[model samples]
Target: MSVTAPSLPAELAARRGSTVELRGLVRDFGGGVGLTGLDLAAGPGEFIALLGPSGCGKTTALRALAGLERVDGGSILVDGRDVTGEPASRRDLGMVFQSYSLFPHLDSAQNVEFGLRMRKVPAAERRRRAAEALELVGLGGHGARYAHQLSGGQQQRVALARALVTEPRVLLLDEPLSALDAKVRVQLRDEIRRIQTELGITTFFVTHDQEEALAVADRVAVMRAGAIEQIGSPEELYHRPATAFVAEFVGLTNRVPGMVAGGVLSLLGAPVPLAAPSADGPVTAYVRPEDVLLAAEGVPATVLTTSFLGAVRRTRVRLEDGTELAVQHGTREHPAPGERVGVALAPTPVTVAPAV
Candidate 1:
């Protein structure tokens, strides 16, 4: 699934990425919350992913930026110019969706040329740009194929070509790879990231898939209740989560009961550092499965189940105190159910919330 970078024409290459700012955006859908004082900023050529659960206002914020949804408050700015009240047609943005949205009758080249045609671009230049766009997506000779003539992945490439042919100031992707199978999703996501990097286009991607967001974006903005819960690089968000919500949402986290005293947490007979300042008291420590290991010398537990997950294996064990923990280790360390094992917590810093 390697994609060779395609060379762009001088005119296309000369385009610089634009800065985008969404300041205190508020979108209310009557009884439902769309957005709540949401604010985000993106530098030129930066890729920011809006990630969260369904109904978390990620899509609403994206639509507002694209002028597809009206905002009740706040302003939208691109390259320092206010465009809050501008129509979608005047936004100079490119967007791709989960659905390919290609015209049924039009071939790949015609579909890619649709945007140029809408702007009344000359037919000769439109054909040249369309051909180049298709080439850019690694479908150089597939321009004559129709929607039915292409696979899901190829159709998506054509849709992407159409979106990019306009050389937009900003690119908006709303779960564009959700419909594909697992392998295709991974392949297309990588290709999308590579193409975006080469083009240096400012992008805002909206998706509920954490892995997808973590893999492609320069920064991930995790949304909750119509606002950004946390925004940071993938490593920062995963390794040093600012809050319990982020730790539990960004990855697989085990809620283990522990006592926090003198800025240290005692979990499974191990002293672990706290990632953030917490009041000294009982708390539910958020620990990643990878941070737990099946050590020979630690708290005794009985293995309840084990599951193999490709490169790693996870085993669930119940402690003598009845506390269940998931330990992730190498596949070679397989432990059968009903077997007694010792579980130990790694010395990694952990995020904790008030004891429930």
Candidate 2:
């Protein structure tokens, strides 16, 4: 016989999610501002990440969507309905914070049932829902454990169960994996993505971790100075970034001085044809470490350093002209720091910006 999965509660399944739209949202903080007419949208069941450095307004934008922070102008909409003025309690959103906000006195099941209790759910139904939520998070047998008795990862799992048990219209994650260790963060992040996919709820996740954001989100919005600098799929953002900020922020890049003329850039004595329009003058070409190749008959250079990264090794080399660049290679035969070598471009397209 084929095994079948359990079904979600009918009432809960009926309220899966809705499209979220932020129209020129603005939040001011006197001296400068929190958000400067920021606009974003997420389709039903789509996972979107707001990624940026500290104080770039990513968290502020998430808070505004959750109705925790007031917006000074513009509107918030869900499924094409205006909810700009709705209070936090009426917004029907489930939020998970970086800190596991579980009550010390409450066990896992009790914590998961707290929201239902506040909504006046009957005791029997609340118990059933709480049990289901715990099972959903792979913590079904640990419901009797309190926060203090559970590990950090388990506590965060309980917190997630509590937020998800409500079956709210939207799911908001505010750097939920920031507090855990590297391994636990990766494991829990994968779990979160799995659960979100099973439920098909529209999700808005905020984080400063590029790897985490790129791994978990369907699309990433890079923010800067209280505004969105660029938004695109992870591959698009990494490969064809619109600006130098997006190119440098989304991944590691090496800025090399080059000159452009007749739609070709001359870098390190090589001619690279430009795919996009660039000013005919000096420019800073951004090249990824992996795009730099170590060849036997290329620009002569001396190895500076080599760092092992599992399947690949990142080797830094200094050219005859004293220019340094990093090259990633899969071979384990690494040269000494003073050993001579040759480096060349990998024939991949590069991004160029005005020289600074």
Candidate 3:
């Protein structure tokens, strides 16, 4: 894609972006809390999403990097230069929060231009840049509308415009689309990804929604208990999860009891390759719903329920051992509830952790 013209004034173009790194970052919050020597980095212009459940330190880590929170240890570096002591104002980053945070009295254009105005940018240049930023967010003609005058999604676009107007080196997104409706959330999410790609600015997106993280990020950092459990591409995390937590958190995984003897997990009368080497013993095998198939000759199971999901149907089946697993297949062929059927495991690789 061709590079768009500069959205900010000429002098600010050089401040575009730099690689970001966090090393041995530590924060204390009294009782065995805060980021515990967390380490992560983002390549120049790479989009990394910090994903996890609430209180998982994803937000805290984002805040620390934004200079909103102080770290008890480690350093924050931008462009290979340490900026651990820099204030938020000096970080050259833009942040969009969950809330719209738009000025009620200010119109869309003025709101987008607010940051520029604070920096004493010439009024005419600020207007031009604000218009450009609004256009970039697909709100070109709505600059005259106020927060109350715009829809939730539109307001978010304005918030994004305001954040991008100054052309910061890094964009920090903190659940910017969580407040919108499901459809709007998806639409805005795609739009955000598009805009980020267009600008090619390094972005750190903090989100608790697994789908959102998987949909937009170049790499996903799954955090647990103030530390990164795993970091990889979405496909890598989904298809080859590194741990039980990651396998369970990123997507649905059916936990079925199995024997881990001979470096394999014996589940559903079939031996599946283990994700990693585990001592021979009983284990809980993790399998995706799509990997479980209905076969004419296999382990006996009873169909508990079937949900019609447009092109695909999700069937819940209970094995003789009372283990319930979900299976997804075409809606055209579905088993009725209470029907006795044979279930088999697909050839897809499975991950197994010690049964607790």
lDDT of 1 by residue, 39-153 (tens): 9999999999999999999999999999999999999999999999999999999999989999999999999999999999999999999999998888999999999999999
TM-score of each: 0.98, 0.95, 0.95
Q: Model 3 off-target regions past 4 Å?
A: 1-17
TM-score of 1: 0.98
- Writing each residue's lDDT as its tens digit, candidate 2 over 1-356 gives 11124455565556555899999999999966599999999999999999999999999999999999999999999889888899988988999999999999999999999999999999998999999988877787888999999989889989999999888889999999999999889988888888888788999999999999999899999999888999999998898888999888988888878899987898888986654679889998888888888889889999999988989999999998888898888866687899999988876677899888
lDDT of each: 0.92, 0.88, 0.89
Ranking according to lDDT, highest score first: 1, 3, 2
lDDT of 3 by residue, 90-191 (tens): 988899999999999999999999999999999999999898888778787889999999999999989999998888889999989889999889988888
Cα misplacement distance, residue 167 of candidate 1 (Å): 0.6
Candidate 2 stretches with Cα past 4 Å from truth are 1-16, 273-275
Error of 3 at 72 (Å): 1.1
Among these predictions, the greatest TM-score belongs to: 1
lDDT value, residue 262 of candidate 2? 83
Give the winner by TM-score: 1 or 2: 1
For candidate 2, what is the lDDT? 0.88
